[model samples]
Target: MEDSKKIIIVGAGLCGSLLALRLVQRGFKVELFEKRPDMRRKELDAGRSINLALSSRGLWALDRVGLKDRVLETCIPMKGRLVHPIDGDAFLSPYSGRADDHINSVSRPGLNALLLDVAELNDDIQIRFECSVQKVNLEQARVEGFDHKNNCSFSSQGAIVIGTDGAGSVVRRTLMARTPELLFNYSQDFLRHGYKELSILPDSNGGFKIAKNALHIWPRGHFMIIALPNLDASFTLTMFHPYESEIGFNNLKTKEQLKAFFEKYYADLLPYIPHYQEEYFSNPVGNLGTIKCYPWQAYGKCLIMGDASHAIVPFYGQGMNASFEDVREFDELMDVHGDDWDKLFTSFQDKRHKNTNAIADLAIDNFYEMRDRVDDIDFKEKRKLEMHLEQNYKEYYSKYSMVTFRPELPYEKAMILGRKQDEILLNMVRDKSQVVNVDRVLTKIKELHENMRNEI
Candidate 1:
């Protein structure tokens, strides 16, 4: 018999779209709704991050939907971070020792459009665009929303509601309202810094203005500008700056002030973006914050996923990847508990929240690492040692590699082991008297991993 229990998903972005496709594959009818008009049809406002780093975890989820190879065709391989210091020559920091292990720079809309197209192919999925969800009936699995196109309000109910809405999720708001009864715990912590998107347009011949294969970062002490390559040959540049300081986004009110600030701090980057001032003034400043909450599922009738549940700062380039991982993990849970919504929802929220929390904390840790410590002598030495360890030992995976490249490893396990490995490696690099011994370091790491595994 066809599964009569319909899965209603709100927010037809990356997670929602993918989840809808997956649910259809599992023989469930899916009602996918989006607040915005379909990107495949209309040109929406350029959202927060134009491009995202798609790593192994995200690729794994795409593969589940048989869209991985197709998605890969649209992505530019970012082999590693190309660090450009203000005063020194630029350097390449390889993400991993393994040549095949690298992240891809994929346009957000391009990928989302592709996913939506694939989701639409399935007859079991019905997608509604421009359907802004106003309120959700948590216990009843019903959503009431305003339909912008029809200029009317509509209501729909499902066997269960799965919310894949982004950070500012209306579905999540509904859960918050019923917090006292559900014992829901939520916290949103914003970074002191915010980001503004700028661009380095393609060269005269429509060629890349900078290295097209690596993520470029011009890290300043208190702020940074990072650029990711687009298939169109232009680089999407983001300026992550404080909101209040003299050189901050808040303080750079006038064109002249922004020009002077760029000329002083980002002089090297100014050439690539001749229209920096215009782009800076034109783009909107986006806030960077982490959202954490408990009891992702309410009564096994409603659940929240993606940024809607665990939004994190973008420093680690894992927000989208983590959301994608959620789909993959949830799908795995479905395999075990087929249409048992109660067990599936309970087990998934209980198991996945810790892993999401680990990545949230790690993303914040990377904010400091990317902006303040990427150029530090100690950090450089530590990375060098990590690279060497990864190259020599087949068993060794750096913290970055474990998180970015190892899709099989849970984020919580990766965070724990990777942090321990990082401390050991950093301490090893700090000892000037000791010769850099690869075998000894590997032994120590192996022992540490073994101990951690046993303890856990």
Candidate 2:
């Protein structure tokens, strides 16, 4: 008889839970371990945080597991970015060419709850909340961790232990010790920016003070504040600024200093935020981290996915989306390998490492573009060239359309193509002599697309 195959997944966050669901659906016995108490047992305070932008990449993964429609029930779609310029009214900026194309904001804990519920229905999956891995025996394919009672330590042997754990992952550390060479090429940059959340309470008439279908951005040169809609007709606003900014909450400790900073920087939106002073001063600061790693899976017996593999900066609004994509890519590899555990895992790592790295860089680059360059005239001109490329080479070339709208292309390939396109467009824009010739650029864009297609 074939041996009973088992997989241990650490960290029951979004990606971990989804991985459990997918594995169980394929008839594999799966054990999910989480360090946190069951989230449902306690109130997840809004003071901590709320939603994430559920983009196409994220939605596709959920849909594969039959969870998308349910997730959509709680999501509020952000049709376009509402940029709050320094002097003018906020204007809508479309990312995918069409105004209707959008990413949705859904509560993080809410989505977690849904995934957990579905996972519970899988008899093949055993979820152990409040259980932490104390040690991992990579040679033996086993995990030693504390149980829920926190008294006796227990050891469990599985075919492989996959670390879906977050950035500071114990499993990852264990993997590092056992197989130092497999240690991914990793780097992290903590942007000077930090974030604090504030709420816009629903109006007395139960109406939203801001547009419910928009991701609002107040872009100042060194900082930005973005607000995404919630189901309760309220918006969750996040204030992001350089750690060294004189107006940061740390420096503006007094109410007078805080108020003066807000008045000068975010005057129009301040009144909409209830208890702005209290929330701003009292809320904990959220840090932005960009992480890149390689070789996500070890053979077919062990693997890492999601944040454990790539923790990206949130500026691109893609941390969760990329994690979800990791799940889908693994699943696809499983299909290609015909459920051969070893082959499936080997293929997964080979296929997904570059994709994850590409998104990490994309996320970092977007930080600069969003906060400092989005409104620059030169940048806008380049964006215009991108539009021309998309229109003229609809079949061969696309920038936002492919990255944001198409899920067929791997993340790494999309980034590669995007960089190539960016280089071409930058050159076109740098030539002031050709600035007035739109038709000439269109011809160049088509030729570039043909050359790119042939090379691919």
Candidate 3:
């Protein structure tokens, strides 16, 4: 096929690669650039997110590129969250009441490599590695960057330039440079807490030491550790804790302090991770933050998507899924606008800005919920009622389900409706005198949703 228009996509990560593949499929020549070496040819660095939860939103995007089934083949189904309380035995909490609803645990690099492979299959898509984007000419749709391997600078122009370069995107920086003209709005809020990746090695018999088909969480009052299974029967554990408290990352510097802390808090998990001390000291503590910005498009010639525009905390496990959804949404916009870059870019940003912002806020809300409230009695009661509602009524959807499973619902709508439902459910569960009637709860929720719909 002959290509008349070209798209310059910055960053060949999950979002960029998927976008490149879809654009090439749509008959536009795609030039995809990545700063790092080709991951397919090199081992990825440790300490980054090695695995991710692949849910409905992400799978919808994969399906658009004909890679859904292949990707699913590489994932392990995580049916629910296994919550381990400090004072009680571990228990499972299903993600959804519907039997078929569950998330998948897939390696981050594995999925990226698969998308890169699919992107490379298209003759119209050109992927360059070790090429760092230095600047973007917003008006001209031109990108200037240094080619590390070639030891020189390079420049390219496209009909439209899309930035998927992640949170520290140079494309986004270019927009910030012209902030006054674009009326750009930007804010980055970091959490006092940070995370470090640890691992639970596969057992001697090559079997999982913990529940294989669940996301395991050990939630403390102010800190927590969560693990997701890998296809190799291993689990990648992340410690989400503060950096300055008495039991924080700053104070647990010595091997003795680490061991003693684990013995006191994560005693059960301590036996599973034998080299906890070594791993703790070797790994880097990554900061958590949410990045939000406006005017994702500049002069309708350049646009930013994924983490480049809205980077959120990883508490809700929706970061990658949200990025993938960006691609799917952008593709939908293209279906209407075709190669009219100006209209397409403008509409895409306008439609997506609020949705991304909604998810960003929801993710932050989930940070506290995951680390502090997951094991609380009131929270547990609310969840139990939510599960019952979901099981009994086909129309009932929890906030988690709406965000995770309902791809048709926008994040903004989900957040608005789900928050109302949460308040009502929590109130009913809190009242000991009220006999929680399923029918009554369902009717009230439906009425609340209708009122919200009318107000909107």
Index of the highest-lDDT prediction: 3
* Candidate 2 local lDDT, residue 45: 64
lDDT of 1 by residue, 40-128 (tens): 88887654348999999999999999999999999999988999999999999989888788899998998998888887788888888
lDDT of 3 at 289: 92
**TM-score, each model?**
0.97, 0.92, 0.97
Sorted by lDDT (best first), the order is: 3, 1, 2
TM-score of 2: 0.92
What are the runs in model 3 whose C-alpha is more than 4 Å off?
1-4, 47-49, 433-435, 453-456
lDDT of 2 by residue, 401-425 (tens): 5667777887777887777777767
For all candidates, what are the clash counts? 0, 1, 0
Residue 283 shift from truth in candidate 2, angstroms: 1.7
RMSD of 3: 1.8
Candidate 1 has an lDDT of 0.90
Question: Which runs of model 1 end up more than 4 angstroms from their true locations?
Answer: 1-4, 46-49, 433-435
Question: Which residue segments of model 2 deviate by more than 4 Å?
Answer: 1-4, 45-49, 148-150, 179-184, 384-393, 396-398, 426-435
